[model samples]
Target: MIYVILLTTIVLYAVIAIAIHFRKALHNSNSHQINIQIFRTLFLIVSVNIGGYYLNYFQVLIIIPKLGNDIMAIRKWNQIVGILLNVSAASNAPILYFTSTEYRNAFNKEWQTIIKLLSFCEIAAATSIEQI
Candidate 1:
């Protein structure tokens, strides 16, 4: 049952990501469209990161307690980071959709910060999952 849910979520995300990528490819010559595409990609990345980690959490939570304290801490941390990435990704959508130049510049900076956070979340996911 859980495997079915995880598989569905992953496949759905892959399809969406591919569609977004193709949309970006179609708009390659337009800077505005390209920027929007970049944002879309980032948003999808956030979604995937969150979904993967949360699904992992659900999968392991029952079994992890038996593995002892360190593993549990790692799982909890990954879950929290996944949540943060999701919020950051959602927050970025408005910046892409509705900001003026000055606001866009500031939002761009915020976007950079979010990217860094997302990157860290990816690294954390990779490392922690390895330990698990």
Candidate 2:
């Protein structure tokens, strides 16, 4: 249990530290579209992770000994971060969509590319049929 807590704390700090460092580097050095998208996505991820941790696990830790979890019968410490991890899972697309213009533009460009390719294939098939 202590090992699990230690590992979780280590991972939490590492993730935040790396994200912060990358964000700073992105701001200081490369401000390109892709870089900005990456930085924004990383920020969103960190927010989600921290939010999830706080929502369930952190409260469990604080409330278990300090106060009490009124609803739950068993106060067995859950090794899993939190139920709100699922919240982060569900929220990725919406968060990215709302947060980053580059993400939306890039998404649109990909669909456009696919449509163009399909159209080209259809045109080629039609020309081959005509020749035959």
Candidate 3:
């Protein structure tokens, strides 16, 4: 169940990244009729992510919440899994930025900062989860 949620969230994150890519592609060039096929593909991807996220969210929040406070073992396992999921999801941001030509061209050396931010977020999330 948790795996499903993480997988879906990862897919959604990819779609969102793709959307950003399309937006950048459009803005980068003056070319008209900027590829409907790409946009269509991105839109479909984004839609899938949206659906997956919601499905995952329902399973995590609603179903998990009902499990109550006594399920410490399950709760700990979920927390660890959630932390890993968030860390993995967040780690992709730097890759996304690097892959997007616009971002890479714009930031150049400073792109490392974006990566650093992702690393920081992952570390922070993991640390917090462990502390909990």
Candidate 4:
């Protein structure tokens, strides 16, 4: 179920990425070329991570069930794959933040707002505490 959904999403993303790549290729613009490269890199990262996750899922659900409790080695492999998958997933955000100008701009704007809100909250709390 979840595996199917993940597979479907990866397929759809690949299709879109390829379409964008071709579209960008036709234009020959420098920024579009850069964007296509970034898209390819992002696609590779996401696909690898998703594939790792699927492999981990298969090991846990299919391999473990058929092999029973005797195989300690498969269990170890499953744990390793799980850790790698998590690390890749964690890295995705930072990669996008650094690579995509739009994401960086949005993140910066949101971060500033968050900081301002936090500072306001702190001031309000301090004034209320002073009244007591």
Candidate 5:
């Protein structure tokens, strides 16, 4: 089931890429790129997951050996894939901060609000401590 899902997704993404690649309208020379490498990161996340699934599937169906080089290699591969998963999750903020002006503005605005709130809390704490 996991294999089917992952294979299907890979096919779907291939189709989408081919479609976009051969789009009817010739892409302008000066194309405005967006998303801050989001697609590449997403593709990495999806593709590496197949390794993790393969490890699980083998363990379930074939009874992966208790200890062997092949099993150890697969386990190591799955571990690496698991860490790759964090790349996509952890990269969004820095990517958006660099790529999107809107994200920067919004982030700065929210950050200011946090700073103000923290300062207010500090002042309140100081006053309360003095009273005590």
Candidate 6:
């Protein structure tokens, strides 16, 4: 099912992220430690949220179908799970943006380069137009 695929993807990402975190932490640098801690907390929160959502999904889709009752309860649980999942998904971007200085700096550098290129292109265009 789709849930299985989503769960698998999340687990894979978590494993890779944890491995990278550990590798960075092994460096024993203070800044790496701080960044690792921040990312660890974020990963924990997101993992819990995703786990709860998947558990609720499994219960609603698999267990409930067999039981063939408690439809209202399943519906309510699904709604709550859906909301939690959405919140977790939405928070991921902001959490990374705020926590990772390297990411922000790289983004800024790329933006500046883009701006410089655009200005150069504009100047080149203007020169060509004048020559014509």
Cα-based lDDT for every prediction: 0.64, 0.65, 0.60, 0.77, 0.62, 0.72
**Per-candidate total of colliding backbone pairs:** 0, 0, 0, 0, 0, 0
Give the per-residue Cα lDDT of candidate 5 at 83.
Answer: 62
Tens-digit lDDT track for model 3 on 14-61? 776566555644544654234443454445544544454555466577
Q: Look at candidate 2 and give me any clashing residue pairs.
A: none
Q: What's the CA error at residue 20 for candidate 4, in Å?
A: 1.8
lDDT of candidate 6 over 69-112, digit per residue (tens): 77787687667767776776566655666667876787788889
lDDT of 2 by residue, 1-132 (tens): 844774585587667656655663444555554555565676676677567755566656665566455435334444244445567656777777777887778878988999999999999999999999
- Residue-wise C-alpha lDDT for candidate 1, range 25-130, written one tens digit per residue: 4444676575565556555555655565565566467646564778767677667666765565365456444534555787789899999999999999999999
TM-score of each: 0.32, 0.41, 0.35, 0.68, 0.45, 0.46
| Number of the top lDDT candidate | 4
Candidate with more favorable, higher TM-score: 1 or 4: 4
Would you list the rank order by TM-score, best first?
Answer: 4, 6, 5, 2, 3, 1
Which residue segments of model 4 deviate by more than 4 Å?
Answer: 24-28, 58-92
Error of 3 at 11 (Å): 18
Write down the lDDT that model 3 would get.
Answer: 0.60
Model 5: per-residue lDDT, tens digit, 66-91? Answer: 43558677687566655655554366
Worst 10 residues of 1 by lDDT: 91-100
Candidate 4 lDDT tens digits, 5-119:
7778789888877777666344567878776767866687677678777777777777777766666866776778778777866776666787788878988999999999999
Error of 5 at 88 (Å): 3.5
Top candidate, metric TM-score = 4
Collision pairs in model 1? none
State residue 32's C-alpha deviation in candidate 4, in Å: 3.8
Clashes counted in candidate 4 amount to 0
